[model samples]
Target: MSGLQPITRSSQLSVEVVWLSAADGVLRYRSEAHPLDGGVHPDDAAWHVSGLTLCTPGALLHSTSWRYARGSVVLTYVALPDPDPHDTVAVPTDAVTSGGGPLHPSPAVIPIEAVAAHACRHLALLAVTDPQVAAVAAAESPLWTLITKLPCAPAGTLHPAQTTATAPHTAC
Candidate 1:
């Protein structure tokens, strides 16, 4: 083990999970440290962490995207924990903009809020396109409401800080 050791993508795999819950007509989210055990898939790790973090079950766990950050390929996930707030923070749905540039050949630095926001936007897309996801969202009242409230635009189409309240959803 020295300074010149090479690294592969799999060697640096890790998971980062955002706990999201809808309350009072808005989405609230929180994230906690999740240490990974070797040989566990990132998505499964996210589910395990979510289970440990939230007591109630039935939270929709989905892997939205991956970003390179902190010297590792971080797989991001969102878990919807509702009917049991669990001290989450509220973020405006319109803050769904990526923090930095695209991760083509460089790692982009993204904040947790932005990550969670992106997750919500991704789910909103699923809500309309995927039948199974749509059914799940429909069953969850709060999740469905928040997903409906969000502008149904594919990721990267909407500009940053676009006021969703005044903007027309059809434009998305």
Candidate 2:
């Protein structure tokens, strides 16, 4: 999907995956990663991230972005349900942080609530909100943070125009 962005608060993610072209096909692996902006921090101060690496299995790539708005964070993924009668891959804590690796050995699907909660937690982590804001954010269903301000280019993913708008620094 070109220019496809998921804005859902509770959408299930099958983990960010990396693929290696093997004799059979593309072997996929998953990992645990925080959003570049720590989208789940939920505090009241401005949050900033200089760089973030989304990793899986045999490769590493930097996101096209560096700085993200409090509202810009959204959970995005491709979820694949398990295929079996009664096999299940236990959700791993490491899976959330480093992302899951290898195909799960059972058959199961992620619930929408799980997706929403994770998205909420992610936003909370990358966020800086006071008690009041935090409470509201926490209570917000399909939780998502919305930010409004003059457009500030993300650190790494700044649009070319944004870069051109800045005056070159001349030190005396």
Task: Provide the overall lDDT of each model, using Cα atoms, as 2-decimal numbers.
Answer: 0.69, 0.26
User: Model 1: per-residue lDDT, tens digit, 1-172?
Assistant: 2122245665576677777777787778887645467888777788777763444544577888776655566788777764345878886566643442322433245677777787888888888988867877777576568776777878778565753445434642
Candidate 2 TM-score versus the reference: 0.19
Put down candidate 2 lDDT per residue, 1-172, tens digits, no spaces: 2222434674322222111111122212222323333333322111112112223211212121111123244223311111111322222211222112223321133333333223323333433434433443343222122211112222123357744465656765
Report the number of clashing residue pairs per model.
0, 28
Model 1 CA lDDT for position 104: 40
Candidate 2: where is the Cα deviation over 4 Å? 1-107, 129-172
TM-score of 1: 0.72
Q: Which residue pairs clash in candidate 1?
A: none
Error of 2 at 14 (Å): 12
Residue 5 shift from truth in candidate 2, angstroms: 24
